[model samples]
Target: MKEYIERVTDGEDLSLSEARTASSLVFEAATEAQIGALLSALRAKGETEAEIAGFAQGMRDAARTIDPDRRPLVDTCGTGGDGHDTINVSTTSAFVVAGAGVPVAKHGNYSVSSSS
Candidate 1:
């Protein structure tokens, strides 16, 4: 993690594997300060496509797979951390779509930045 932070802070882009390793450290063993440093470094250095994909892979690795029986599902997932302080419409939209006979799957996490 420190290596990643140093490299990114030095304006070096991480390769896919390096980004994946860094993300794994973030999710598994990184301290809060290390996480913050890495994020700050990445933000300052600007994220690359490989970095984004690698981080996404790391997230997938950490997440539980839920294979729904239904096929052709609609996912209405949001981060809820946009810092807009606006009302969330994802849940309502999911309900409306379901009412209209469309399959909708919504994420259940609460807003992280502002009240909805």
Candidate 2:
């Protein structure tokens, strides 16, 4: 974890393996503060595609999904870094789009910092 933090401090991007390892630590972390710092650091540096993929994969591996007997699925998403006191525009847009005969499975997260 310290090594990961150091690499971010030096303005270096994480490789796929590094991203996976660091993200896996998020679930096994002993404290919440460490998880916050890890995410903040990655967001501050602007996650690369490979890094994002690896991190997402790690989360996916940790999650359990059920195969529901439903129609085919369509998913759309966005990671919000919008300013304070604002609603999620992407989710709203998804609603509108889905209402117009499109399927949308939208997801969001909390983003407290990033605006300069």
Q: Name the top TM-score candidate.
A: 1
Listing every candidate in turn, what is its Cα RMSD in Å to the true structure after a full C-alpha superposition? Answer: 5.5, 7.5
Runs in model 1 deviating more than 4 A are: 70-109, 112-116
Off by over 4 Å in 2: 67-116
- For model 2, the run of ten residues with the poorest summed lDDT: 107-116
- How well does candidate 1 match the true structure in TM-score terms? 0.64
- Model 1 worst lDDT run, 10 consecutive residues: 64-73
lDDT of 1 by residue, 1-116 (tens): 88899999999999998898898998999999999999999998899999999999888788766558776677888656778876677767888888988777787688877555
Error of 1 at 92 (Å): 13
Candidate 1 residue pairs that clash? none
On a 0 to 100 scale, what is the lDDT of residue 98 in model 1?
Answer: 88
Task: Give the winner by lDDT.
Answer: 1
Question: How well does model 1 score by local distance difference test?
Answer: 0.85
List the global CA lDDT of all models. Answer: 0.85, 0.73
Shift in Å, residue 13, candidate 1: 0.6
